[model samples]
Target: MATNVAMDKKPARQTVPNAIFSLDVVKEKERYDLWRESIACIFEVDGDRALRRTSDFKAHVDANMFGPIMLARTWTQQQDWKRSPSIMARDGMDHYMIQLFEHGQMQWEDGTGLRELPKGGLIVFDLAQAVKTRTNDFCNLSLIIPRTMMDGALKPQFDQHLRVLAKGEPMVKLLRDHMLSLKSVSDRMSVRQAIEVAPATVGLAAACLNAAVDRENPHQGAGIALAQLTVIRRFIEANLSEPALSVDWIARHAGASRTKLYKLFDAFGGVGTYIRDRRLRRALLALVDETAQYRPIYDIALASGYTSDAAFSRAFRAKYGIAPRDIRGNQARLVDIGLPTDDKVDRRYERWLHHLSV
Candidate 1:
């Protein structure tokens, strides 16, 4: 038996300004107050009066600015945190926050009512909206994105605040991995690189949010239809090779009636046509892929749910105006495939949060 070995290389660490604040160095008597005052610009914190007497107050934040985005890690003891209308009005921190708690639990109330985040789930917060949370000892990674940037990636009608994505969701898992990677490699990135990559991070965050939306059962309407359609498209893309892929199968799995499914995909000429087009497009990519150049065309067709070579060729030709073989070795460019800066310590993060729009 032969096995392949994986090669790993350490990232070259670069010197960049990163803000760090910790209660470790602060006197025990002053730790709670310092922690409270430090993040006052964003949230008001209050300790359990009883716990304050017996517990060792602990909290710290290590943060970096990526263009208009901010990423940070915070560890804190049991506390209650709030962001009220007055706080929102005073600081005017109009950003979207995505948080994943690596440890502990939190229960928060917002415009959407009560939402609880158990360990390992991702939670979103809209700074423009008010929220209050009570937490146990926890460590969390936080991403702060300017609303303007996040808005472009999310649907306007989708209520994102207080929405939580379970740790098990595939997209949420990938997003968590991305946030951790960003934190690790950020030091190696230049201000311009950080700025350039901010949008990509925002896009991933939006995907996770939309995936969360799909997991919920929404009422009938254009907004619901659109959200369902997004989920269906992803499903179709993932299962294109299934021989049982059909409108009825999709409708059953997608939890939509045949009429609703058809109506939802009307702009794409109908679900059947859309699926066929996707299969053909996917087949074309396989044919032109350098790594798959040696792959049998028949195999590609079969994998695309085509049992007969002739049928696959005709559909491929009809959609692309050429046979799959024509573009295989030709390597034609397919037009289809849709593919900071901060320093300071002290109240540094609060200052950065306030000026994130800049």
Candidate 2:
């Protein structure tokens, strides 16, 4: 005389590495304070008394990280933002930020001088430098990328900070559309897919920057090497899966000499090492992706240009100190380097910024 019973079980929720902060959810009295604290990592923010009032405070942000790059769409009331020498020394980040204002206006002063950013203007900021800005109630999209990722794309002394491009230019429009497209589809992209897309996005950004520089100064020959290296890097990213992706093939295709190509990547360990590192990293991501669990290890190895399973295993172990299958589905979560351990403080955005690395 046993009775049958049904068991109640709920599926575990999937976690995505994204942040959305809206002032509407915060208590009225704490909204402005929370907003200022949330952005403390990148900017010291404050507003006029009227905008800072409990009843008047308003801000919203949606941010997503794709490997070494981050894209954010933000809306806020009038505020002042500053990045001083102390803040730069404390944070120790030298990343590049490309911001596009969709509405409202802003006036900023940096080492270059004071400038105004009107609606539909795109500007670049170098985080290593000092700057201050006062803005009208505004909405904007920001793309933040590490300087390491721009290695071959931008010259070290380019002085591109505060460089603005208006929406009227065809190249600017294309660049804006590309960044927006990535944002729109980011939610559906897996960690592996996002990592793969980062390089291409950087390439488009470099193209826009180089075009701007060429138009501004035709006599500047300093960027020739930068442009050549950019082409080589983009070619490497596009053909990482090909087994024949070698220095000779890349040199021929990218119009660079073998010696020049080798020299260009010398700082990053030679050209061969760069290709091997990128391929191994891609394979590692694919192996850890839960959505790609059904894919065979051999298939992943082949895609990474390793035809032999043993070779792939040996190379993977040598690089990561673990077998390819050891941490497959067990470690599907995104790894955040240098994230804060204290949970009592709400620094989610700061954690995300810290997690960004090359």
Candidate 3:
């Protein structure tokens, strides 16, 4: 519940430069002129090839391209030459560049290997080493981030793989969707949002790469998967009263397979059983609340996903060893029951009583 501002309020000295621009409204040549000026100023590129331009698709480049953390531009271009190099120099900064190509073909060297990227391929390269890229007609999304970020999050697999196509990976699809969503509002990202999203974006990138390469580290993939599943469970709890809720519906909305979804809730039992227990718990709390005495038992049952009051009462008695009517009648008296004399009482019983007044 703590705000990000409250967590890191030392004020970062504002040393990180901002290099964002838009090319939709400018002339083609003028846009290209501004691109050279902005990139050269930020990266401090002294060579003429550092400012070279290669194609004409009305392309636009707006980026925060320096320091330990930077944003890479996503552009669509068509090249007539057999080999065209966009930028082939070193910035003396130790960072990793990630490229996710959507279409066409390109090749590059990342010090360890010569990576050839086809359509739907992904490439990760080091910035300290000299690299050359050749593309005929390419459209891709690129990310420039600190090497330490990958070192901590990715660990062993960070250096083992240079390029991947990300075939059949759910995390890759999620990263693609998030990047596209961010691109839709590139002009409106606040400085704080951009900073917070940077690490989360890196985490996703690491997850996609690890998933693609079949890495053995379960912690990286499990952490992101659990966080996403927690969000989905919160959504399910918020809409419990709606009769349309089901495993298939929640899985579809969360963009996960039913088997993966079930595995996510393994610590709490399976997804279907979890849903049933949550509903039963809610119904039990309703039964114990003094103000709910006027409500019909059938209404509470329906609200908890039970079609019939008789079936709800059966399951409630099987779990709690008491009828729902008795609990509703003795609601006020049950509060007098003393806290556990030993440490053997069920915790769910305490939780139900705690939320009864809310």
Candidate 4:
């Protein structure tokens, strides 16, 4: 029999927000020139920076739903490129800027400290700050989002760590991927999609900021730490049957060092103890599985990573105040034993079976 199935090729129509700009064109040098012209125009009209024609530059501006974020590469022959004092006056309008160096080095006085933003590093500054950034020849990415949009996502405590060089993280990779995807399908996104995308973008931005900042509220930070801990614990539970699952393995899977992994588990108990407890608990559950009625206690222990029946029995007795044999015996007698017949008993048994399968 031959079957024909039609597949839809067009995207679904949704209420999409207006897109500001997309990096559609890739004229590298021309893009940079455009950025320089725009900056020069701003400086000329507002008299913010002491506009110096000391460097040849190139930039590309990719507009988002709210505003434009630019990737700029520029060279400077002189060291006098600085922002004018009048620039600080206009900064009250609340313009935010983040500069990440792709190559070369740059220096700036960030009021609190003289920050040196090296290659692969980032610096964030408010237009209102009396700060001046200087570089001989630097290539960088600059992101400019509305201040109102940023205010909603970032906590006031993270203000100091606003500009951060991203270390390797899944969230960072996700944002980079999303940016690339946005560039590809800029015109396809509907107005509603654009609006929805903004919140997702903010969530990623907030995560990045959270990674960079040291929170004043230790309690709130602890909650985030606990959530991450839960993820690690869940991973441990899923792979308990694998004999090779050790502390090092768990650390590698959790994207944390062995020491950090141990510390995270130490809040409940030591990692070694936790692993043993979890294995024993899983073995106990498997012993009660009604579908596995024919399986021996030794087989259940072995499946849960215990090598010897004697060793497994000793641990099981220590944990549950009874030997594995007694536990299995009790489970087997559940059908034969006379007990009170109630709706509660039936519901509890059904729930237990469902949990065992899970």
TM-scores, in order shown? 0.58, 0.60, 0.41, 0.39
The lDDT leader among the candidates is 1
Model 2, span 119-206: residue lDDT tens: 6768988775568889988888899888678877864446666778877877788889988888888888877788788899998887
What TM-score does structure 3 among the candidates reach? 0.41
Clash list (residue pairs), candidate 3: none
Q: What TM-score number comes out for model 4?
A: 0.39
Q: Rank the candidates by TM-score, best first.
A: 2, 1, 3, 4
lDDT of 1 by residue, 1-358 (tens): 1233223545555444588886666667766766676777688889877666654877888999988889999998888998875555345456789999888889976446777885688888877666789999998999998876765577656656677788898999999999999999977887778878888998998888877676433422544554566567768877888878999998888787899888877766678877787787568657866798889899999888888999999988777677788775433323222101121325467667877877
Among these predicted structures, which one has the highest TM-score? 2
After TM-score superposition, what is the CA distance of residue 147 in candidate 3 from its true location, in Å?
A: 1.1
Candidate 4 per-residue lDDT over residues 152-184, each given as its tens digit: 566643342235555355555555455455545
Score each candidate by Cα lDDT: 0.75, 0.74, 0.54, 0.50
Runs in model 3 deviating more than 4 A are 1-59, 64-68, 76-90, 108-116, 157-161, 215-358
